[model samples]
Target chain A: MNGEIAAILAMDGIASGAIYVLIGLGLVLIFAVTRVIFVPFGDIAAFTALSLASLETGGRPGTVGLVAVLAILATAVEATALVRNRALHRLPRALLFYLVLPLVPAAAVWFAAGTTLSMPLRIVLSLALVLPIAPLLDRIVFRPIADASVLLLLTVAVALHFALSGLGLMFFGPEGVRTKPLTDTVFDVAGLIVNGQTLLILAASIAFCGLLFLYFEFTIQGKALRATAVNRIGARLVGIRPTSTGTIAYLLASLLAGISGVLIAPVTTIFYDSGFLLGLKAFVGAIIGAMVSYPVTALGAVMVGLLESYTSFWLSAYKEVLVFGLLIPVLLWRSLSFSGTEEEEAEE
Target chain B: MKNSIVAAVVAASLGIATAAQAEITVGFVTSQSGPGSSIGVLYDRGMKAAVEYASSVGAEKVKLIQLDDGSDPSAATRNARKLVEENKVDLLIGTATAASTSAMVAVANELKVPMIAISPISVAANEAGDRWAIVMPQPPSLMVKIVVDRMKRDGVKQFAYIGFSDAWGDLVYNGAQKPAEADGLKILTNERYARTDTSVTGQVLKMMATKPEAVLLGGSATQGALPPLALAERGYKGPLYGTPALLNTDFIRVGGKAVEGVQVSAGPVIVAEQLPDSHFSKKISMDFRAAYQKANGMPTSDGFSAYSFDAWLVFLDAAKRAMATGAKPGTPEFRVALKNAIFSTKDLVGTHAIYNFKPSDSYGVDDRALVMVRLVGGQWKYAP
Candidate 1:
């Protein structure tokens, strides 16, 4: 490939990878905290995007913009309510409280941006919506069934999936709506054209990743979150409330998913049914990351994006087949490599 | 409401008293849900308008019963039987999709109720033979032949076919292939994809690799337009060709500027605006557009209005003939009279085209009905 084409491909890969990372992060967060998969994460993203797009603008700010404003206000009220409740009585709970606080700002930005918002706004809004959702889900479904066996939890997740799918159909209609692009500008660099929105997505993904790194490396709450992930009971003994900490982790993951949705909406229009496919891909990305290690998961997402781009370029017709072909082998390799660690965790 | 209820009660009593008496009822079946809802909407509009027009002319009220088949063939068969055996509808008009239409045809033949298909004529029309069935619209194969002939006249030689892998696509291909070959136009590539396939980028790219002068599309409005748009984005400047399906307003909206030069062979609906002498056509076109806009809050496509109008007109003409022949009101004899009248139609001026039905011909094929159009400034305009 020519330099320009290569650059364009690279940019496309990164943008696609960023979307996957956000979705994977949410999945990882929910799984880490609750030991349960949050299947509705993608549905929420699809619903929000569709609802936002459907908002008609007669004049002034549109319905989507108005909804976004209301959502932001709600997030603020909820955050304040949490603070007033003395929700973080324990040190571990306090750490989780701090971790989830960023969600308020993220959601506000998301709502403020609306449908006319740029790619960056989409990323921020998505993250914000998802963050609160993760904790809310933990409070509602997971917490109620916390005492249930793994099999029971899995069954509940399946039930949640069906319910969410139905809800999506009822709200959004069966036909998928194409999302309007943030910008139609195509930048020609060295003979390779890249959509401006894609570049913005890449930049946003890097910034979000950097922020995540800083949060986990430097913040007290971040370290506690990590400690909780390593040994839940041990962390609780060390003054970390595993439940609250897990909720915080889930919130972060949800936020990432929301952001991914935002980024993805502009690139490819979102439908109520889009979430299942995206969620499946994100699960593969997570598994490829060994279902642990944030950096590794993010990297896995990028690789998947690259694979998708190349397959679409070359095979085109059987691009989906190419995706599954890569996913199966990678999953098998990861399973063999992590068998020992899984056995150790089982014994413990 | 009280008076009508009392009258209905009295009528029911009288009807029960005369149980052995014959009754004439018209059954109208169409897709009210699923992917083909648009077609159903058109059918409803056409049938209702025709009924209204007939009533305005002081004709007897033709009891019209409607059944929703939801575009499923099995549902259509069940519904056809219910209309025929249970409801005892003397004449049947409907079954929108190819599958549903075929199933209904078999039921109609078995039940011996004359069937008038209002939707697109399928490939099965060729093998249908001298049965009690007649299609109002031109057959799919003939439509394709006309499209290719028109394109051949325009100096287009090399061609590529892009269509959804379904019965509709098969009909178009079967019709176009022979004529195209005879005209000396080389077929560069022929590619088919599923209707639900989001991206036709692969199929399009493969076709583009062959570098054909023209691409013929045989899919629904959305599917027909997208691949062309993708081709335009890839800098392919060749003419995009399509069947009547591409004449829809949705195609223009979705395809945007990319569809500007695309040519399609459609019925007379799109060209109704250009026909200055035809007052009936002008009025139907105007009223349809206005009603559709009022109902859906968006401009209705020509296909929806034209198809619906033609379907209604066919029924109205038949009903009038039945009334003229002195067939007893609401009897099986009246239904047969109406069916025979429809078959006897020689040159009826319609909103789309003049329909001529013959008892000897199993399928309806009106040679004068087809018109070729192109997407010009976001609307279908006369191509040549």
Candidate 2:
């Protein structure tokens, strides 16, 4: 490919990579705070996009504005619930609690928005509806199960997966539904063709990463969350309520996931099962990041996305085989590396 | 309490009286769920409507025992057994998927019951050894020939093939290739993708690289949407063609403006507007649409339902002929007489085509009617 074509392909790859980064960030956040992999994170994304796409009237307000408003409201409600519970000390437990609570409201909003709206509106509505859902999930299913075994928690996650998948099927039906892009502008700058929506997604990823980094570094709560993540007992002894910090972490992760859904929906139409594949990809990205370090995880997601895109472009039919084949070896190496560290940490 | 007792007695007596009267039972099986449910819905609606119509015209009431096979071939076999041995159905009609149809055909031949396949006609051809199996809809191969012949007539020389990487896709490609090759039309490229794979950009990119004059898509509307969308996105403005399976609203919903100018070979049911105005054609178009929409929330597209309706008409006409021949109204005699009458059918105008069945050619190739339709304003408009 010439420089111009190469630049165009690179731009497209980056734009696609941005979506994976956002989704990966959400997975990392949930895993970082609660130490539980939220497998249904992609379902939240798919549902949110579906809701947003289903909410469009002939000339009604756009999905972004509606989603922003809903996100603010959900954040406020979840924050209040955390305060009332006085269980702010156990940040991880609280985070799990908050993540499970929002599914009901999310489903309700999805149903209400589904009947009247156009494809774009439904997608936006779905995104807006799911913003609070992650925190709500933390409050309900995960919080009570915090003291349970890791296997039990994993089982719960699997159960949640089934529940979410079933609920999606019940609501959306078996066949996949398509959504229109939020914008159609494809910009040609320096021989690089970038879709307007993809550019926005990239911008959003950068903005989110920057904002999150700032929050974790500068804010008191951010430090508390970090301390809690590092050592929950030590953080509790130091007067940092780790539980509340975990809740905040989960809420932030869910917000990122909801936004990711909104962004990805425009590029790839949201379907009920779209999340399973995305969740698997996000999980792989998180694993590549060592399930810690937001920047590393986000970068990992981008790399994986690029790998996928390039492989797909180059190999066409066997792209999946190439990408997945690469994943197995990487995962085995990571497992071996992590096992050594985990043994050292235990001995220390 | 007294009224309830009297009503129960009346129901029991009526049931006994109906049981006393000689009755013929027909079992119908089709998909009620899964990805292919839309076709199943159409089949169910068409079967029910035809049966009701037949009942209204007949002296003896015909009972339809229905079962949902969920589009699973193995489940279809189980359902076939249930309909045959358990339900003791006199005749069996079923299965929307090719695999399911094939499985049921085996079961029907084993059980020695005449089976009418309501789905694609490809399965029937695959199991041509089964003498009892009759495909109501003309085979995809025939449909492919129709499309290629039409394209040839229109002076198209070069073509591309983009189809689902499944049995349905293979059937269309296999059928279209021989004719296209015979007509001196060069096959520019052929690409295939799994139905579950949402993205078709790579396939479209590969196909466009070959630069064919026209493209033939062999998949359902949802699967069909991706290639056209990718083609449009990549600025490939060649003529797009598809199979009857693409004649669905979902394809337009997904493909948007890209669906425009794309032509496909559709069954007579979808291209009913092109057929000459006749009582049979108009009634089939109007009544089938209304009844299908009423039974199922969504409107029915082209499927076995049209053939099922035709099958019902053929069955009734045969029954009337049998009665005319002084055959007894009892089950065995009625079945034998009906089978003989059906075999003797000639020049009978039905919904799909003119039926003329013979013992030598059970499916009656003359009944096959195909038309090319173009997507105009998100609706299938017949292309002459």
Candidate 3:
């Protein structure tokens, strides 16, 4: 490739890599904080895209049903907690948080169905539908076994990913849906035209990273999440409820997935099975950071995207095999560097 | 005593007549309940409609027992074997993809039962055994010939190729190469990708760098639509040529406005109405559409559907010929007779082509079966 093409490919790579970073950030955050690998992150992204497609067609998204179901289940858990603790007087607050809050978004979604809404409204609605399920999933699947080993949590995450994919296929058929590009302006930079979407993607990624840094460094909830990530039990001892902290982290992570999906949908086709590959690529990026460092993981993800773009030009067939093959060497290096690292506690 | 003997003979003759008139068992193996099912459902139902139409027109009773292969070639082979061994189907038909079609072809040849293809099994005439198997759709070679012709006519000199990293891609690329090369056009680059690939920017960029005058996407249906859409997004302003399988409505639906002005070689059934009145396939294609719509509420938008429909029509004719020669539906002799009758078919016009099955050519379709079509405003228009 010439210099111009190379530059353009790099831009394309970084644009896509931004999406990977969103997913990678989510994966790393969920893994570090909750010890759950968050296997369904990509699926949630695809679900978000599909919901946007549904909304664009003036139809209610099926994800609204998922939200309502999760809300009811979470509410029941809360109600049982209040009743069993003999705290019936606090039932109203519990109901308001668990029962009423979730339905508001779902009801808004239902009322918004089949009405020609602006693109921004549809995007927000998509985010609103997807954001709640992360905590609901945490409460429903991971919370009961929050103290369990990482391996068991990983297994549960994988199972949830598989089930959610099957549900995605049932909800949205086996076809890839592409939404319109958020922007159509193409510019010729040194005789190489770049899509406006690419620029928007890069800008959004930087902005999101800045916002996230601010949230974690300045916000009290963010500090609680960090404390939980440091030590789940210690956070509880320090009066920071790990559940609420974990829930906030999940919400942030899921929001990233939702936003990434909507942005990436214009660039590529998003299908029910599309998430696994994207998720796997992000997982590789997370692995590169030893699944800990956000800046390192984001940088690694950009490198992965660029490498994938360049190699696919020369060896298109083995591109995936090569990209995925990076894992072996990275794992070997990590093992050699951190030989004294303790493995996750095995489940009984 | 003589009159009693006459009565016994009459009763025995009636029994023989009923035995000869038994419902002809035909097994259909297809990629049902799997990734290919969306297309498989259409082809399967299309054949079902053809059988129903034949029954309405008072053809010999036929029992089409379908087996789902779940999109695996091995499963399709097993289904083919089970149908022949357990169900005792005299004739076998199946498979919506070339790889699985190859699998079913082997079993059909081994079991010595006549099999008809509902999809393009292969492009080579050598693969077609004399009396065992035949294909209904225009082969990939014939279809690609039209694509190359159109590309040349449109003044494209350099061709860049991208297709599925699988058998179908290989078939299309290989088939497209010979004619394309014969025309003295340079093939700048060849890229392969999986059907489930989310992005083709890398490959598309490579093609963009090569700056080919035109691009050929060697894929079928919705999967085939990906590259063109990607190319359009990347602002590659070259004509896009596709295989016959790009005729499906799903291709149009997913491809959206990106597919407009893209040229594809497909069966005349796709643009049946647009085909001239003098075309051989026009009348039969409309009839097949009518039968398909009458049975199912949706119109037949895919030419692959007509493939199975044509398969059933040929089977009906072959079964009639076999029955005339004193063959019974369940016997091995009946299968041999059906095979021979199929081999002898001449000048039979169906939805896709004028099929003249011979000992040398099982795929009896000609250029008449295919039309060069261009996407115009989300509709396939025949390019004269």
Chain B only, TM-score of each candidate = 0.83, 0.83, 0.86
Q: Pick the candidate with the highest DockQ.
A: 3
lDDT of 3 by residue, A192-244 (tens): 77778888888888888889889889999888878877777677888998777
- Candidate 2: interface RMSD equals 3.5
Question: Could you give candidate 2's per-residue lDDT for residues B178-229 as a string of tens digits?
Answer: 9888888877765776554535655665666677888888877565787787
Better of 1 and 3 by TM-score: 3
Prediction RMSDs, each to the true structure: 7.1, 6.9, 4.8
Give per-residue lDDT, candidate 3, residue A78. Answer: 74
lDDT of 1 by residue, B328-359 (tens): 64466765676688788766767667777777
Candidates in order, TM-scores: namely 0.74, 0.78, 0.87
Cα distance off (Å), candidate 3, residue B327: 2.8
Is model 3 an incorrect, acceptable, medium or high docking prediction? Answer: acceptable
Q: Order the candidate numbers by lDDT, best to worst.
A: 3, 2, 1
Which of 1 and 2 is the better model by DockQ? 2
Q: Give i-RMS (Å) per prediction.
A: 4.7, 3.5, 2.5
Ten residues in a row with the worst lDDT in model 2 chain A? A57-66
Query: lDDT of candidate 1 vs native?
Result: 0.66
